[model samples]
Target: MSHSFDPIDNQSNNEHFQEVLDKAFSNPSRRSILRGGLGLASMFALPMLPGCGGTSTASDAAVGAITELKFTTVAKSLADRIWVPAGYTVKILHATGDTLKTGVAAYSNAGTDDAESWANRVGDQHDGTEIFYIGSNGKSKGSYSYAAGDKAVLAVNNESSAEAHFFHPTGQTSGAAVGKKFDQFGQWTLGVRPAAEAIKEILMHGVTLVEVNLDASGKPTGYNATSALNRRITPETPMTVTGPAAELANLKAMMVTKFDPTGNTTRGTLNNCGTGITPWGTLITCEENWATYFTMPAGATVPTDTKLIASRTRYGVQTTATSATAATSRTQGWHTVTDADPTSRFARWNVSASGATAAADFRNEPQTFGYNVEIDPANVNSMPAKRTSMGRFAHEAAVCSIPVVGKPLAFYMGCDSRNEYIYKFVSTKTWDAADIGGGIAAGDKYLNEGKLYAAKFNDTGQGEWLELSINNALIKAAAFGFTSQAEVLVHTRIAADAAGATKMDRPEWGAVNHANGEVYFALTNNNASNRTPGKTDAANPRAYKDNDGIGRDGNPHGHIIRFKETNSMAEATTFAWDIFLFGAEEDAPAVNTNISGLTAANSFSSPDGLWFSKSTGICWIQTDDGAFTDETNCMLVAAVPGTVGDGGAFTVSNTMTVAGAPQTANQNTFVGKVLGESRLRRFLVGPKGAEVTGITETPDGKAIFVGIQHPAEEATAYNDVSKGVWPTNANNGVGGTYGLGGRARSATIIITKDDGGRIGL
Candidate 1:
């Protein structure tokens, strides 16, 4: 979905990465630059991203490199269809409204499905996906089995209701007739948000589990509609809230609602963006942008305790103070519906205080979201748990470090908003092989007890993880008032702010190299308001107007960053870092913008998803972009990434117009080895207006399941062809959109080589 949210990135006290580069890299021996891939430097580079194409030259065997990408570069495309290299083929396996039960009518592609029907249908806007099989190989069970009897399930996150335009017949009910389009009336719920319409939209924003069938060759065939384990986790599912927050005072007191008086459980999960496959055979679906679901109605008289006002203001759910934006910014207006029975399920969304006490009303509802939720796929009846110890924010992905026996495990995560902090949760319990299939019990043992730390990238290449715990004096004495470990976990952003964590450009998905322990994250661009001339620092070095014709100035083309833990320890508090790749259009300036030396073949912008194939060890980077859309839709690139500090530290001279004059400034930062076209090239491109995200390959590397989120997401009307017509061949198959005349849907596609060889090799 195109990002639509009022960001709570208003932080002033925290120290942004400052400039102190001269002494940071004083030691000359450690500086190194990769000299393998570059050719003669070109002063004038091309401006288009689709002009270059050829085979990749990346090494077939580096120190842990399992396989190299062997496919030809797929050119930039604007068509409404999936494009891959010459040998691969694409097949749609599952999509929104697809039936997951034994008996159901085919989705009309219209907004006519009954409200109760959504409970058994696949959700919309597919994001992160993980394939889990039942059998055991070693590391956490599941993945890769040619046996005919193996059970496999795919957990796909439905991130948002961005594509809700198609789910309804006449579009959302806005105030005016023009409100038929989602943009015109998306948040005008007070006008008329029918209970039925509101319920359907709410049900489509969580996660979906479907049983995938693999062929005899160990490649995925398709999803089975009637599998027993298939289900939709919507806003109504019962979820147990675990971790210290569930037991402590100030935080525990906030979890009460008429729906769950015990204060130990909550109802459902929403805005599940990215996912983490646990070492104990479970799935951790992260909640992102969940704050927009509730309305803090400007001056509505509600609970007067006022203890949560500070935390609410910091999180953008302002109660005592609300502007015109906050008044009507309720994403779906589910709160406007008048459901009278059973604690008024729809009323939970309107969080203004009204009843006698905190438990009487739903004022504390928003506090329940924004955490990493654990779900055990191996057990169909296991209840989901909100792992509050992981800390709450707009969680993107939770990528776990490679497990070592008797060593504490680390799960690296990024908050998906501009100026947000990245975090790592280290489990107190060491890895024990006995918990491989221990299910939710293993989650209780590890996830419920952990130490959460926020990242602090120093001016030097070295960085440290600032612990967000009561034991930390800084966290304990912060403005949010950390009374206990629970308050620190509940108001984690406030705690990280007090700990002086470094702010990063919208950090999206994170992935750990299976072969090596180095971790990678996608800094998916920043804007003019948050980044300025002198504010730019080493870790986030670029801040300039885009000279490209697209006119996205403020670091619109984002970059990928990687870091290695000290002494390769998962529990290390310090690490070294570098930029693995800088996303840019091929035609951008070569000196600073195109510093990674990308050609037309491998150029991409706004890397939002990062994953390493367990079978091939190939780092897969996916894009969710708006900067370079005129030339191409979002895409996925397969890479063989180099280690940290593979490139030397150098001064980055950026020219930005401050006030009315143009000025240039320099900052020192590190870049990893440049892969050129051969090592890093475009692997796949999605249909029009869609984000290419969430990818996972089979254990044998035969098939890769890629998610195309909300194809034609900007369509105003159901029949609007100018936006796109895809996954349907109604327009006689034109260059891009076939003009299929059908509603667009989010889906997962299976890509495999025609010759039955390993994908990307």
Candidate 2:
């Protein structure tokens, strides 16, 4: 992402913040969403595709019985290949356009596949991921298994067509206008997107499920593409809206379209990103950056409704009749495409008013997204449900508190933008271990009713949750209008704004500690305006130039924030907080930028994907970066974490000369003890032009599944291969003349240990 931006590109005064093809082959050729969550006002300024080496952070200290990462630390590399410790191995499980049905042919990777072929193929730009094991025998027949098993179903979120050009014969009319993002929608100038192309895009997003085989060996092999459970839940899939707001007139009225006049159901999920696994063996895939998909016809009039306008502005939803620069203002023209279908599937992308009634046009289409959609990966016949009770915004991920036998459950979430807020939903129904195999029905019983709240952190290492509901007096009489809870859920950003929630940096993925249930979130980098002067609060304090003297400003490297719930209880409204880690270049000034005493062995930037291994209590951190791509591609690192208050306070100074006048300000922030080599170390480095995200491990922690998204995004044309060559480079090294014509596909990879020992052990 970039350091500065015109207000028009982001207007972020406050708020926030792939590729493929398949043939998932090593193309001797091409490679490139820094996608959907392009908040109207806040998007990560991705650098245009496309390394380094390291030692192990010391593993001397132990947190309880949880030991440290034991593999020879992976060296930070720019080899254009996936690099792991010497004892580990990486396997390409599947890639974009890979066939899911046995009869389908392997992808040509030359962009020649017919539109219909995608229905039976893997979707592009994989994001969030989860696995559900199946019973080994009739004794556990027809039921999902939580324990280790041979047969398991995998659910992966195909976020966006980060490199849609690979889907066409020639290049599509698209360009990367912001940072280094894939920008599939940014450079498009098409007046009427072709129906065939449009349909491919429609089917490319949402989630993918397939059965896989796990072995007694340390590494799990590949998937069963022809398994009866293999399926794709794309935009055309039908789903019901559930939760507190589902029955309210506001949501129903706003959700009504010709396809579903009653507004009880909607079609498809988009921009699926982070994920959460319910204790009941189901997947909760979050919808991030779903707003930009529905744009008003270029040069249309803005909406006149005060509430509507406020909600659009707050959520960064493109509004009616707005003026945006060339290509930047338009999407691929999904609304302009014409088709024979009666439901106006092609025309539904338009959110502009054109008809007399709510059911007349696709004016309300945008309201239907921005919530977490639940899927039962093991049951292909079951319908997915959108959990509307989890107030919508640009949702990144949902990390649940460790389930207590009878205590209430809490799902922590982030808005994923500058100045946005972190939120959580407390279920009305407490945890019940009996619901372990309950699937979607279990989702209905627990997630359907909850009290939502936004987080507020004080400078003194303390924080509290502010309720967001009509029941709250502040929301009841707010100037935004006193409406039903449906309006509150739908316009959550506005509700949080009214509640005085703390503005964070771009909040991304969050993970809860298995040891003590402490919550940790990744505030993945920010620019100057978003973290403006005198706005450095304790939770997000640093603002400085990078160590390379590259002139990069703001908190470019990002940091991880952690907290302990009051009394270590999930239902606590107040908590203690501190910075668990401040990502840096390892050589920055220790007093400020490198406060955690980072070393080359464990330095990283833009901490976007984060998770804690439940089996071992070790923390896993992944990067999706634009700030540090020059020296290395994105990567995954492992660390042993300390408690929230273990860190000491440090004074950070930020100096910037305004119009030739030098000025400086300082802020004191608390942080955890430096991890050094023992507690923290690099684990895996991915291929060039790809993001390292979406990770999960098998029950015994012997194997890990990770998503390598949109590699070789540096290419400018459809057939450009010189910029990226991967998957092909995966097993060996870089191929001739750029993959020797191999295509770069966003793929799911499995990592295992050579000795059949637990991974990273």
Candidate 3:
């Protein structure tokens, strides 16, 4: 169970946008659109100007639209199996409980796989993966290197686990018999679970590294977990902290445990979502939605310090609850320990003021999390580090642009929350080809020292990247004054707010079009309560009800927004912007619902994971949805995306209720690109109840990997497998009775052309 949704930080972007909208729109038509707040349809009324930050005539050539989609679109399906184009073949490479070492017994395909084996096995909820080519001669390029090889090392993130019941026969009884407890969501309720169960689940929440080999025919045949390169970074793995905040006095004051009195080291990484590879041969694994996993101990008083209180409040940490026996809000009941020392590892889950000072308790435990963790995939023994300079709030993905010869590298990131701001980090060090194999050392050079920036999009087709540096005048005068640079990075959302960053609609994954130096992000839906008419802005413009019957509104179908930095430079503060794609049902009217002209082959909702393939220049869009689930399972779509100003401009009439007041429908114009099935086609629909995410391909685009997450998540109990069983029956048809027999588990599958040709060609 992830943390409950919190909108505290979202208000900053809205407040800032309101100020900008007040100054930009002067005409009556513009005022009507600005009155309720600009919907996406009204923001992109002009195509992005090339070379500089100004409007230009919209055109397919201006946006750099790709030629066409190559393969036939796979039809949408609610099947209990994977669906792909006719010639594409998919094979299960690894799934939950698969061995990572030679001596481990084969997974029994039953829930009986011992809790102890989970650490040495592939984990649950696989997401954000990468494949590192290992040549037949055992030689390879740097960590960021991509190539074709008969052998490769694959890394997959196990985001989280299902209920304890899924691991046993008697459900909670099996757990309680071993002194386990569960939360309302049926996940382990207490912070302290049965030792065996706790260890298993904790170990499952990190990354799985394994080596895979292809047969003579070039098809992936088998994988070996016993390979020397195979390794797992569990929640218990020790890691060093780096960046501005690592050595802060306040941070040190917050640490008292044996793990790190200096506050420069911490254990484990959680909620690892989208990932990135660096030019220096390393993996950038993001820690997202981590704040919800912590809780305040019962009876703990909220801190008295204004800054501490404000920071905690904004990050969604419980500070006002007075309950003495239960947590105010916690993702996992990791705080409900049984018999353990108050200062023990389990005690760290409850971040309460229980001791004389910050260092005497676990009040600062969460501060160590929510960062982009860097790992050297080539060096299995290398320790991961929390790159704190990347600015921590709820990180989605860290997509870096192509490194220029002498220019500083830039990384684009999104904070995965309602109306959070998009961010960028520019390395202080310029790029050098010699550092290709530098690994963590290179990370130390480029990642440790950089400028973090937040974006502010003006309604008049322009945007600026505001520096979050303490030297900036606006941040310096913030109500929650920052005492150090580390403070600004740690409480990044607040700093971004003070810097006047634009709030987005649940910003999730981001991708950089390395070809044209353009960036795209998935603004995955917001509800009416948070995105009321008055709350919409240029970047997050839509606020209308959908036919999903979920009763949710405010860009429920979401859209993909793209922009180009001036001079095609990553460090440039100004950029041109436009709406690249709007998610909608095919048959929906051409109002706000089907603005992108999506046809039957490509209509989708709640766009989440996004990746731009360097090999083929195709932007792959994956869905994690509920609004359109009644018609189709989550899917993966391949798109030959156009650049910034492809579609020119458009408008729609929409009725919305402002911050508590009802407003009549009004017409608004927005600049956006139009894509049909020819350019954007659904390539795959996942098993029922599974979200399509984590996509990557070989250098030649011959072997592609996609993550299947949370299969059969709707099943009520351990024995209720009738709801949906995937992978095991992925080749079988829909309905309660399908293929092989087993429970559902998140796994990564390999997709290849049956003809052994390049995929998406």
**Candidate with best lDDT:** 1
Q: How do all the candidates rank in terms of TM-score, highest first?
A: 1, 3, 2
lDDT of each: 0.74, 0.70, 0.70
Residue 739 in model 1: lDDT: 16
Q: How much is the lDDT of residue 749 in candidate 3?
A: 83
Candidates ranked by lDDT, best first? 1, 2, 3
Question: Which runs in model 1 stand beyond 4 Å of their true positions?
Answer: 4-6, 18-68, 136-140, 144-148, 175-179, 182-186, 245-251, 320-327, 649-651, 667-672, 730-741
Task: Supply the TM-score for candidate 1.
Answer: 0.91
* lDDT (10s digit) by residue, model 3, range 1-761: 12224444555534544234434433334432222111223222333322111111221122333356778898888878888888877777777778888788777655556766777888778889876655454433333343444457778877875544566544433323432334433233433355545556566788887887766544566587688888888777788778853435554444344456677688889878888777765678898877766766556655565776787778876666435554323545555545365336566766776667666666777778788999876787789988888988888889887677688888999988876889999998888767765778888998988899999887666788999988898889988988778788788888998898877777889997644667889888777666555544555555577765666566678888888799878789998776677788887667657877888899998889998665555789999887787889989988876656545556655566565666544345655556656778999998888888898775555678889988887786766677687866534422232222477777788888878876676
Query: Which 10-residue window of candidate 3 scores lowest in summed lDDT?
Result: 51-60
In candidate 2, what are the lDDT values of residues 133-233, reduced to their tens digit?
A: 65553111111123444467778899986577777666553232211223534455635566676777778888898887666642468888788888998
lDDT of 1 at 661: 80
Q: Among all windows of ten consecutive residues in candidate 1, which has the lowest summed lDDT?
A: 48-57
For this target, which candidate reaches the highest TM-score against the unseen true structure? 1
Backbone Cα, N, C clashes tallied per candidate: 11, 47, 21
